[model samples]
Target: MTSLRRRLLILVAAVLLLAGLATGVVLHAAARADRANRPQSGGPAVSAGTVTLGRKGRLMFLNAATGPHRTAVASVPATDPRGGRTASGLTCARFYAAAGTGVCLQSNPGVLKQSTRALLLDSDLRTLRTFPLAGTPSRARVSPSGRFAAWTVFVSGESYSSAFFSTRTSILDTRTMRLTPSLETFSVVKDGKPYHASDINFWGVTFASDDDTFYATLNTGNRTYLARGSLSRRTVTTLAQNVECPSLSPDGTRVAFKKRVLSGAALWHEYVLDLSTLHETALAERHSVDDQAVWLDNRTVAYALPANGEVGSSDLWRVPADGTGTPRLLIAGASSPAPL
Candidate 1:
């Protein structure tokens, strides 16, 4: 071969080899980042991973990652005198487990003239503190760090739901032990319109890791909306409508909420809304799910399926967050399910 041609070939070959090496490096870094950004199974490891649920008037631990899915390993009876079980015969309606802490909400009998309470507990079901709440309990959430807890409920004659319905949502800082009695007093900005309306009501709280930021549902002016709330500014801004019971995914990229699918009916279908794109994807669960959905992981959401549209009884079922797969019944006779 000629010397000139050989030299040119060598240079070209070296350039190709360098480009290949660079591509490999880029691929490796991308893979690592994808794994890092995925939702971790939160909290320390238990035996083969476990989940908690409220069933039969007690808190029970079940399998989270492995087989024997609905089996309960340990339990804390509602009547157990050890923890701060409230005097009103507290029955946990909504339960949240995260950041090594848990919160269980219980309420009085009816929508009006009602009282609710939040029971804060450790990983071992030992009561850390108790916060007595007002209104009829509906939804509850604790931040990923377990430093902030929030809840929402319906009150009589103050909400737009009915002549006898109103709402009260509250947040508590476990780190400082400071509580906001009601989020109703906070300023709200809806569609760029700032308002302080007597008829403004809120429900369904899902917290960000920062604990100061949260997402909730509000009912005002005969319409319901998804609202983003900031504790520092004490304000909530509306984002979308007909969305209720916003549950922030563990990865915090999307929110799983119930969207009313039926016209002139109280029935709702669950959906996931991507926060960045503001796009919503209807989940596979076409049945009316009246409760807030909980994240089993970033890819899966668990929520209770109301039996015959009844309130006090339901079965826990899980659906893919991607809106691709059918819901599989995870636990029977369980109302609320949360991964540990």
Candidate 2:
């Protein structure tokens, strides 16, 4: 070969070798970081008490006892909590609106790295304990009796190509902080494809005051509706339709949810449905709300509504659970408000 051509070939080979080495280094570093920072499982299982709720995106402190006007217990700034981003970063996203004493937070570190961890905090804003989870957590719930905890994890694989695989609901003995293996895992079914997606997600879970049967919503592609599932039986039965975010009454007789309708837009308004007759009623009718509803009690419900037409900016509102009283505003300009 000519001298110029030979030199050009040599330079190309050198560049390729360097590029491959750089790619390998990056992959190795990411894997190492995942292992180093992944959240550890096993918290001193304390007697389950009031559940806590962390608002999605922004940090919100709400006194689960005071109902919603007071200042938040503590707030986490919108930074990545994974340390790979920054020391002050918030790693949890799409946090389910927690509603007992506090909310359980789902932190997604990565799939293979360290699965999501459930961080439970108290009203004083203390770090209660980190509940290590397997797979990516899709939803979490603190039992009403404050004696148990349950969460759903979503697992994805190529075998379930058309659907996502969700592990059966993980029921935790709050006192032990360990998962009960007796309960069967629930999966989403669509067009004959089995999805590991948690049907009990984004406000999909509820527990009875007696800590017996828990209610959740499952999306089977054909329909998204409420299902009453026994904690022990691990069997689910469909109850109502067109409902999302079912918040069972403190008494476990009724449910409060966002009654969705096909508007030109993709938002659903908050509504309450009777579990007995499956009757539907609107709390804020003719109004569109994108936030989840928390039943303060059998008679009261609280949620956030966007004010000034601003997205990601909202005001907390409370209304009678019976759907009769005028909507009252509690906290203004707050993005998320969870009932204590």
Candidate 3:
């Protein structure tokens, strides 16, 4: 009986030791998995050979994996080059070209500045050249080929005058820096004139891959949709309505924009519209969102969303283009995100 009791006590000790070892192994494995899925701690890890522009007017061209680096370009001054329209006060805020190169428009600094100039900068943010504008061009986009540029010019008469406000679409030749002499080929006046604020007031403009065709949103209209225009035909058509912040896919096959759908309290949702069928797939439902989207390849999109109700504390979220998966955060503590 004593021997049997001693054996039982030994067996219980061995079982406890084995159980503790198993728990330790499981905890270690879980920690390893968590480390693997964790987001890297740093700014965008751009791969070798990337050109990026910062919000503070700093342009950097560097290779992350490699040691290659280049600072600011020498030609373009850091000052904002202003031109196009006096009322809009347009500045060189962001890049709009479909090509790898960056194109920006800024109002020149001075008294009595009438027009804004389209400043062509290299990938390194070096000033290559500047194109003067006849009127104030609001949203300027370069074609995929980088050969042509299409922009919207919001024209208001002299500041003191009460003349009607008008907006015209213009296409420019990038190589020659000349406005297409055939004005009728690539231009469009808005459907109806607004009250004509002395300043330019519009969202943005974009050009098709062909450079000749383009799209613009006229806030003055009752139903705001992507207006498709033809340069050769001089015609315009409203492609889709109830959408804002239209961003074309990298392939130019479809466009992603935020559509405000009233879901029990005027909630807004974003949807991706297929240009071929004009069909849309709802991406997300949220309270408020900034109109900025970065296409992560053709199948995915990355955007920033407020964490809870605080806009200052935001996180990077990504969703599949097919609208299959749930919205997931890619990286947290990302107040502002720009896709590489």
TM-score of each: 0.70, 0.59, 0.52
Candidate 1 lDDT by residue in tens digits, 114-200: 566788867655667888867656777778888888877666653233445777888888888788978888899999999777778
Q: Write the per-residue lDDT of candidate 2 for residues 187-271, one digit (tens) a residue.
A: 3333344445424332257788766677776655435667676655556666767776677787777888876576333567778
Quantify how close model 2 is to the true structure by its C-alpha RMSD in Å.
Answer: 11.2
Residue runs of model 2 more than 4 Å from their true location after superposition? 1-101, 106-116, 122-125, 132-140, 151-170, 180-203, 263-265, 307-311, 335-340
Off by over 4 Å in 3: 1-92, 106-117, 131-140, 150-171, 180-203, 262-268, 285-287, 303-317, 326-340
lDDT of 3 at 244: 57
In model 1, which range of ten residues has the least summed lDDT? 81-90
lDDT of 2 at 243: 70
TM for candidate 1 is 0.70
Give the winner by TM-score: 1 or 3.
Answer: 1
Error of 3 at 84 (Å): 36
Q: Tell me, by TM-score, which candidate is best.
A: 1
